[model samples]
Target chain A: MAKVVIEALVARFPGDVYDPYEGAGGDDCAFVQKSKIVEVCRFLKTDPAMAFNMAPYITAVDYLGAEPRFEVVYNLLSTAHNHRIRLRVKVPEADLELESVTTVWRGANWFERYCLDMYGISFRNHPDPRRLFMYDEFVGHPLRKDYPLRGRQPLVPEREVKDIFRGPGPVGRD
Target chain B: MAIEEKGLGERDTGAAPRSAGERPFEGQHRPETYDGPLDAPLGGKQMVVNLGPSHPAMHGVTRAVVALEGETIKEMKLDIGFLHRGFEKSCENVTWGQCFPYTDRLNYVSSIMNNVGFALAVEKLCKLDVPLRSKYLRVATAELHRICDHLTLVAAMGLELGAMTVFLYGVEARDLIYDRLTEICGARLTSNYVRVGGVSRDAPDEWVEKTLQTLDRVTELRDTIDALLTRNRIFMDRTRGTGVMSREDALDFGFTGPCLRASGEPYDVRKSAPYLVYDRIDFDIPVGAHGDNFDRYLMRMEEMRQCDRIVRQCFQQMEPGPIVVEDLRYVLPPKPLVYGTIEGVMAHFKLVMEGIKVPAGEVYSYTEAANGELGFYLVSDGGGRPYKLGLRAPGWPMVAALPHMTKGALLADLVPTYDSINMIGGEVEQ
Candidate 1:
């Protein structure tokens, strides 16, 4: 079943697909260029022959010394066909950016934000491209290989509390 | 804060020179310069209020800033991450087998399910097959945890909405289930009972009997809740048509479990992609006509019954045998063997020193968790520790779609709507 879907995908986009390996647990995994992710994903989601409706998640793995330092993975499942496929996009450290797939599946919004928050990978054209899990003031990506496990930072300053019983600004009357 | 005072004669002299078409004050003369309460706007406009980062109805530290025009909510924005503990980052540092305890914190209400999910993901990566008895036992434990989770959620939702009796009954039933869990495993709340290959311990002699008694109690409680809330005018008025999510919208938001089933899509991971002995089980998938808070509540009630049936069948079919795999590489040797033989001691030492080494690959394992599809995307570089671990919590997307659910609903409807979704703080923020 996976071979049929992979073959169909390869026939449509020849140069984009490469080194299709049967995943460790029997799913078919194909490596594709980062540039073609959005297009390929849209096809896989909407194509009549291979309609992969549910996108379980989008995550990235950082390979410290490899040429392409990161591999962004998307796990797509076809609810209609009851089959699964994995798409891995090699993302170099220097250019750690990929097109956003929120337009294809609205569920991808937070998953993409998580990838950016953990791996320092940016997604172009994301509707709300703010940090999801980390606070606005958090420093470096904590999930990177170089980040120290016990690294700590100073706490954010607390805001002053207002007096609830008092009416407006200053207490004294003019 | 200084209070602005009106002039001494302002109250009596309020009737200013009337314009051509202006009407006089109705009865009593009103003060010309009057300021309303501090929180309300002076002019008639939408009021902005923060619901909670620590309120009881929020389940945990989750804040929702709601904009209201009178009693109706005009806009809502969910602010999360107050409970973020960097679970994925922690997994990167821990050994493969050591991550099980951490999974317990994800969905504390159903900690055993999270443990099972992580164990299954690691087992898939290692290409290890668990024993048949263990398979049935896993299903039994997972289903038991599912019922407990649903009971807690229903109880909390009821308590938030002033149903004291329902809360007491639900918690009582859940505590009974916990007693059984404590017998099977050592702990009740965070039962790290699942390992890479199999369960940590076998069931006690009276475990099945106790489970059957608890199932009866839970069913009776479910009936009481159904009679109390299903057709009651107040409960129906408050929950029906509130936070209505259509099938398309539910799918677009990546809903699963009873919530998605209530939306009329039978895309259960157990049915679509059977992992354990689910393929052999016979049960009906209950769905709802209108995906509203009421539908979600009723769907969970029906699911608990289905889970009870699954547990009964598991005990009927399960046969006595080895609980863990026979492979010495994955499963730990018995204590007698370890103290009696030199090879057993060496094996124990190696197992403790070096955790199970997974192959260099990736697999995405998802289960029909209490809330929805709880997925674990694991990437292993042939090391004792995982290269990367991503948890696809169902609550994450549910929290993301909260604004959509509460857009134009009444402000008071927010609690029931949010509670119906069952957004766990640990899972969402992780």
Candidate 2:
């Protein structure tokens, strides 16, 4: 099933794509270069035969000891074709960045933001590039392999609450 | 001046500006200074209100910073993650068998479905085919959880819109279902009944009869709710045309389950990708046209009936057999055998000591949860614990689309809109 999609992907951008690799449970996965991810994803989504419309999620896996330290994964589902394919982009530890697909799929906004928040892999063209699940003051990406499981950092001092109602008769009156 | 004249004079004065450092009369009030376009239509800036991190209308710990132009919401930003417990990180740390309990907390409303989804993912990775009886039982449990989930969602939506009777009726039916579920699995909300290979135990004695009785009660309650809210002018007025998400936008937002179905798309995982015994069952996928709050409400109500049909069919067709799979590597031996036989004791010891070893692979398994598609993407390096587990929460995308849905809607419309989406905090944050 994935071979057909891979063939189409290869037909369009022959040199930019790699042969489909067997993912877990025999699911087909095709790896593309980090630089060409956005263009490839745009083609995959817009191509007539492969209408991979639904961008279910975008997540990252930290292969701590592997050659490429991180693999950013995008799970795409084609509601029209009823077929699913996973796209993986490998990023080296030193250069932890990839082009964002938010322009292709608006739903990828939060998913990309979450990937940035968890794995500390920056999406180059992401719109709202801020920490999603953690505060801005949080020190490190918690999902990284080097991060300790129970590591805790000191929190910034709590902000003092200002009294909104200063002009008053009795303070508690309605 | 006389009291009546004083009141008239005060009304005439009307927000009069006070002199600097001059104290006004005790009963007089002053308005805040506004610094904006002097020729603005409303003569002031748009009011920015924090709808919640603590507001009642917000079903969970979510904050929507709404910019209001009078009563209408001009723009809104949703801030979630208050309930984030690092569930994925936690899953990576736990063993395969140990992760089952944590799955229950993912979608706590339909927790059994989460367990089923996680189990299916692990089972797929291990290449373990669950037994026929276990499959049927899983379908039955999942459908029951769906009923509970939809009922709670609709009931809560009704309550938020000031319809108390519907809430009571819906919750009452859910309580009966939960009672029966407690009989099957000891827990009510988080029923950790599904194991990796199969269910933990078979149906208790009289389980079939009890389930039938509960189904009857649920049918009656659903009918009551329908009659009360289906055509109720107030209910329709509040929900109809509010929070309308077009089909294209809904698909683009990656909506699934009832919310997506409400947008007139007949995409159901049970039908599209038939997992378990859903392929064999005869049930209809209820869909709606407008994809508004009312349509979502109607979609859930109709889906509940379809769940009842699925549950009835499963109960009738379910053959009496061993619920748990016979794979000793994954399943524990019976208590009697463990106590009596040396082989059983050794098997139990080995099973408990070394959890089922999953192959080096990855799989994405999703179930049609009450709110939407609850997917679990699991990556294993042939170890006891997962290398990485990504939980694709259905509500996360729906919550992301909230600002889109409520942009031009009124402040009162936000409550029903939020409730209609049925965003569970546990599921969203995870």
Candidate 3:
């Protein structure tokens, strides 16, 4: 399945497949242009032989001191081909916006939202762009490299929930 | 135990209160306040529901703030980190070798895979090769671990549906595997067995023989479980069409392992991305056609049977030799050298204190874990500690797709659908 996608990518983008990031043991190994991401992912999903219909999940890596600083990695696997492809988009700390693949893969909705909330990456065309993991009041993305190692920030208070553990006895005296 | 069907109504996290038809897991208890949003639409008709970091159906302490209307969940925003213990940040502070025990907790059930993944990452960083004996030993223990994980999931899925007996049976069988693990390694749950280049120590003769004997017992127990649930009308009916995710849906969501295979795809990482001795071994990848909840259940059962075969094969192909590599830079010196020789003692002390300096490189190593494709993506900056570490947790993807799988289904079906995912806490907490 990845062979077909790589072939198609090479055919369509010419030199894009041999992008600098694809070099062996490179820091930005899986890097691909953010502009062509949605198109490539759509082709991977729709192509009958490489029918990778699910956008399973997206994870972000924070290389704070490294060249690119941030990497938004997508793990796409095809049920049809039983093959997997790791697509990475390297963005500097200054610019984090990437085209959202949710339009092509509906399952990417939550996965991309997570990348946005945790790493503070902006998925440009995300259908519902609200926070997924952190609350609305969260000041910074927790997964960022610059985020404090030992945070002095205020912690979110636990909600006072109904007592689902009540019995006919003292709660904590035992 | 009395099974209470609590219909907490639907709470969606994305939008204004919509009709109940759009919401999933309606009537389910959520965490936090589901009160009308402060920016409620003009008519002010939105009702809030909180699914929690403590709800039973959450699989773990994962909270979700859902907005609802009637019985429909309008939009659901998840609230996690209630179970986060700072594994990644802590790994940076600890010695390189000390991190093995912690990896066991990640996807708690499949400890061996987590251990193997971490060991592989460190091995790549250190450029050390494990002994042939250690490789076979790792495979043997890993296969056993996979069996235990599958059993636990099957039992948990049964218990979810009020089938207490099946849960007990599976738990009992798991106890034997736990005992076997305890015999081999000192601990049962956190078997910090894998070291940087190899294992902590070679498996004792008695332990290996005992594991094979226990496996024989496990086969009988597996057959009983098979007979009980395989064709049971109730089990079949409930799971047949429940949580029907297509092959396309499974792959698009980046599903792997049994979940993807259950959807009729034969993409096992053991075969596709063969590592360790998986390529040398011959085993079949069990697949299902419908990709329903039932297929997931049956696929897991068959996979466990195959794991038994793999374990037997590892034992038959076992070779005796030094388990740890001879490289003093990568692996600590032997016990005699560490205890008697000054250089060996100093090397051990240095490794324990400062940790080994790993070459600057990044690698994504994945193994066929019981749940699915368990991947460890580690980034090293030519330092003693890892610069960035991430896991492509299979459970995260499975749980993320829960809403899509349950959207139109009745609230009662949600529990079984969730159980089929077999998601443990470590991966989802992040």
Q: Which predicted model would earn the best DockQ?
A: 1
What would the TM-score be for candidate 3 when compared with the true structure?
0.83
What DockQ does each candidate score versus the true complex, computed on alpha carbons?
Answer: 0.46, 0.44, 0.24
Model 3 bad stretches (over 4 Å): A1-11, A14-30, A43-57, A66-68, A75-86, A155-174, B1-52, B64-78, B125-127
lDDT computed for candidate 2: 0.83
Task: List the lowest-lDDT window of 10 residues for candidate 2 chain A.
Answer: A160-169
> What digit string (tens of lDDT, one per residue) describes model 2 on residues B1-430?
0123324333323212112242222111112355677834564457778777988888878888888767778889888888889998888887788888888998887888989988998898888898889999998988999999999998998888889999999999999999989999999998989998899878999998999999999999988887777656577777877788888888888888888988988889888988899999999998887788888988888888889999999988999788878877788889899999998898788777766788997787777888888888888898778889999998888888888888777888888889999999988888
TM-score of each: 0.89, 0.90, 0.83
Clashing pairs in 1: A168-B1, A169-B1, A170-B1, A170-B2
Sorting all predicted structures by lDDT, with the top scorer first, yields: 2, 1, 3
On lDDT, the leading prediction is: 2
**Candidate 3 lDDT, tens digit per residue, A104-142?**
877677777777877888899787898765667779886
Q: What fraction of the reference interface contacts is present in each model, in order?
A: 0.63, 0.60, 0.33
Which of candidates 1 and 2 is the stronger one according to lDDT?
A: 2
Runs of candidate 1 exceeding 4 Å displacement:
A158-174, B1-43
Instruction: Compose the digit string of candidate 3's lDDT tens values, residues B1-430.
Output: 0001223245233211112234332223323354678734344344566666687777788765555544455555566667777676667666667777778888777687789878876776555678888998888888888888999989888787767888888988898998988777777788888888888777776787888888888887887777677656566556666788888787667677898898887787788767779888889998887677877998889888889889889988888898888888778887899999999999888777777778777666667788887776777777667776776677777877777776645455667787898878886664
